[model samples]
Target: MEKPFSDYWKEYLNIQNAPCGQVGDTNEDTLNLLKNSDVVCSVRFEYRNCRTRIPVLMKMEDGYKAIYPHLSAYPKESEAQLMKINIQIAQSAGVHITSNEIIYLNKEYIRKDYLDLNEFLLRSDHLFNRRNKPSKTIDECMEQYDFDLDEWIDTVQTLLDSPEFTLDRSKKCTTGRRCSYYDDCFDESKLPDDSILFLTTSSHKLQAYANGIRRISDLEPEDIEGFKLQYAQYMASKHGIFYDKVALKIWTSMIQYPISYLDFEWDTFAIPPYENMKAFDVLCFQYSLHIEDVNHNLSHHDFFDTADCREKFILSLLETIPKKGSILVYNMEGAEKLRLKQLGEQFPKYKEQLDQICDRMIDLSKPFECGLFYDNRMRGHYSLKKVLPVFTDEYSYHQLSIQNGLNAVFTYRTFDSALPEQKQVIRQELSNYCKMDTFAEYVIFHGLEKYLKEDDVNA
Candidate 1:
């Protein structure tokens, strides 16, 4: 920023202009650029140590307008604070700030919201770290800033004045996931393998950790809100597994003949690509179905398409799934069943047929999700990927080119630009991945059936 109109900066931002007279170190390049251009993308500025990044700066007749693009469904409070703080930064930098708008590119739709800094809900006016607070890291201290100059100065002085150093394990909990320095910073290896700190519930884990409850064994029934998955996890930590044979039997009994294990892989577009699709609607482009008859003959059925797949996807599914049997889907509420419902809504003509299929659909995950079946090997998680290994190690996502749904979606996204050979390979990998998913459901289903039959024989 010291060298205004620097070609490197312009090139980095991908907005290069030819021969703009820019005075060095005088903030003249920004003025020159604004004078010539209607809009500037990603105008960067630093004020009061906190970073101010404006995505779009439009030269308006009145003054200037800042447009911040928010990609998520809901903007976080901290994000809003950072956005509003830009107005203060622009004022400091002598850019006449008139209005700020947030252009939401959310999953629902594109929306523009005018931000009134007068309300200033994100206003901050201080420096001293709260007694309970972990002192700001080096990066935080150096980059701290405020709308109020006095408060910004206080932030600097407070950092210089020295603050209490509190070690926050929770910070390590998440930062460790991605940060390489985490291993050196915290020795979580000291904690038990089944540490209560690893509980999925954040509030509960933090509370228990604060109370010095270290291991999973230390947690009692009273600690959890109610019985179910958490209780299964707690008990399994001691016993290594939990199998309510009776409950599992009941779940297994619900299955009719010629059971079909269903799985869907779909791409979610922020903007609706198809006519009937709403924003964030998933286009069901691929499916894998495994049907097992009474005689134990297994057949595989699948469909995949890159373009205009909505109608074909529905028709293929209806044709593939047998008319007279149970349709078993893992995570019915979220995945396969939901896809069916959406397809039905999108194609009203096929709603009756889709509903018929939906009626036959049964969630195969009921036993594991409800804690009727659990294995410590699952590590307190019940996703098909997590649950698959307990039943058999013969199959694994690691062995496949496309390991998960997201990978399949990402690969399909590149299909349009792919070379002919690449296209064929991509198509095959996509099919294999989806096939594996339905097969995984079958593996689990078969395991359950075998478990029930063996239990009955022993009884």
Candidate 2:
């Protein structure tokens, strides 16, 4: 549905809330409307047999500026580079544009980003057409975009007339992401815990898998680079389990009289829900902390709210968390510690207090991640849920309505829109989920300590 230039300009000024319109396949409609409005929604451009619709065509006082809006907070480097290619491609098709820019929707409301396409030219790959030799300018590269219309038509015809579809396992595979047909292609359950394909941080695992190196035991020393964790995985497969007692002992010894097992559940907004928030900024709505004293006595503390909970959340934590103990969190850098630091940064008054909390915080994942402990059931994954199941079936997230952090946040996001009864149910589910996280932390922390005391050599 194409709209008049007035509607598009009103949308730019936020004067009217209009439904997102579409770009017509016909070029003349867009071409005529481009100048009448301050902002044009989509301008269709055709180059060779290939075509694309530039998301936004802003009418500058001089000429025109092309804008490509990215839905994600920060788009991939390739995608950003592709935006420049698209503009150059448009220029090649005689849609002369003075400048081009990429807009992150969540950010563009207030923030202005200036992009230098020249800085990206050397690395930009062909968007629609491949070239045998590299081109010096973006325009030069786009000029070489010659799509074989007949070749594509012929390929489509052959596929349509094909009698049977056959699977070819011999073809090179992309294991970077698991697609819908992944399970049908590879029986992941049959792979051993220490399969060469599961080698930690190795990009060439597909090459190893293709060469018939199924298990880590089958891999020769020269086949893989000697990464610290990779060797630990290899040794774990051979020696039954990998237990770096010295490292475990050092880590365990860091725990003080009172230990706080902390877990946080936060919501990330594409648009700023509150003041002083950047795009995709986290708003911590809930947290669970389980403090265990020297006597092994456990005390649980938690915070939850539907509105701006930052101030109250920190106040509750500062008061609840013991002054002198190692605060345990699954991934300190990524989660709890980062949250605390951000909170301190956001609220400067609490900077000292939050910094103190961060100083005491320790990542409980060190043992498993640093190769101090390993179990075959872990399956090369060290997430709280994955690692928790390895210790005992007594605790499982499968029993909960809200199983993961993502689920909890998603449920939380809908709380305002939900009916009263639905809101109550959501609250209960989120509370239970957050409570379970800290409790799981408590269980896992003790489980590690017990494993150490029970070990004859380590004890």
Candidate 3:
């Protein structure tokens, strides 16, 4: 595992082929261990094929190492060139292996019983035996890692660079849901406002980052659109080229057919609340649907402050929403669609109607997700909170009673348990927050249309 190849596998492929012992317990112990040998060989299985042991040869007490095949009959120097070289190197110096006896004639490799770091920790009860307690924060961990996050980032970037590897833009990053680094690396704000990720790329966002374009400003929408007009046009346009201001204008101006802006807030309790439900039952409690008749005048209908009436409330929501109108929601791809699908599954009798409702659902988040719209003030974030701020000076979550969905849901859950005075205050807060979501959508829709129509707006 000499310099290049040792780093090659470890950094690029995360494949470690090294001895299974801790190095340098004490300088004296390490010196004693290496004194009898000038050379050492270690073998460890590669993760992809656990059955195969990769042999690594190292100069004892030195970092220099190599990986040569293991076998019987030390080849004569007159024959087999690579083997002869290895044998000469081995014979001249004292060779050390797992077994004290290193037979010069026959080298053997044994299949290993393997355990990963996590599995080893769990088996030793180091992970699970700990009591629930406050843990070190990011700053603390950073201090332990030499307080050089830039170095770690450089290491990761260097490892990520590759001409052969690319992203599959058509598919979602499957590991995102489970990875601990998901938020740290792939959070919405980390991407560029005009990144190929927001538009269309053949590889994932990280790959794009490694390719020297960490932000949305790095993309060319015209080039992307030229390649694939339908889905990837937004990616190709460097100056927002493919964004059809006229098409967006047409959609926004069609405020007829009794328009509605819809939003829902739900909670998943660790313990089941309803019958036949296991732990982590997602209960949809609050729904705010703001409707406008043909005149574009707005009135809102809401369902909230219910704990025991989930089924009854859902039925009420179904009745409140009109069948034909466009149903607007933020991030419907993840939030609205998942909720509706779950609702349909829970109520088989109304599955067809629920599916139909989903069919008419219009995602208000399209512009942000597509990178057709961006605001410098947002700092490359498209969350509802960030997007809503750019729309109107009159609107804000800061002055509201409930500023976020999580807090709103928590308040709704406890509203009934509060005294009469607290109940009124909380109910008003919940109402105000939910109303703001719909109102923000209304403002954001108009803002996007305005942006699209503006001649000077950047891509």
- Which runs in model 2 stand beyond 4 Å of their true positions? 1-39, 43-52, 58-64, 71-77, 80-99, 104-187, 222-224, 457-459
**What is the model-wide C-alpha lDDT for candidate 2?**
0.70
Q: Highest TM-score, which number?
A: 2
lDDT per residue for candidate 2 within 234-284, as digits (tens), equals: 777777567676778788899887999999988876544565655566889
RMSD of each candidate? 9.2, 6.8, 17.6
TM-score, predicted candidate 2 vs. hidden true structure? 0.77
Cα lDDT of model 1 by residue, 1-459, tens digit: 113323333343344643333223234455556667877765755555554456667778888876554433333334444644676667777887665554332233321242221221121222124342324432243254446655866877787788654456665556437467556666766665467765554457777878988766678768875757777777777777778888887778888989898888988865455566655678888898899998989999889897769999988988888998898898898877788898888889999999899899998888888888877777656888988998999999889998877788899889888999998999899999999988999999888877778878999
Error of 1 at 10 (Å): 19
Each model's TM-score, in the order given? 0.76, 0.77, 0.50
- Extract clashing residue pairs from model 2: none
Report lDDT (CA) for all predictions. 0.70, 0.70, 0.54
State candidate 1's TM-score.
0.76
Better of 1 and 3 by lDDT: 1
Candidate ranking under TM-score, highest first, comes to 2, 1, 3
lDDT of 3 by residue, 1-459 (tens): 014323332332233543332332332333344454443233321211111222344453433244333122232222223322333333323333221111111112111242122211111101111232224322232233323334544666666685554333323444335455445545666545555555333444456555776545455443333323323233333443345565566666654467688888888743334543323446777788888776778888998746656667668878998877788889987786777786676667877888888888888887666555555545444688988877787889998978999898778878777999998898888888988898888888767766765754664
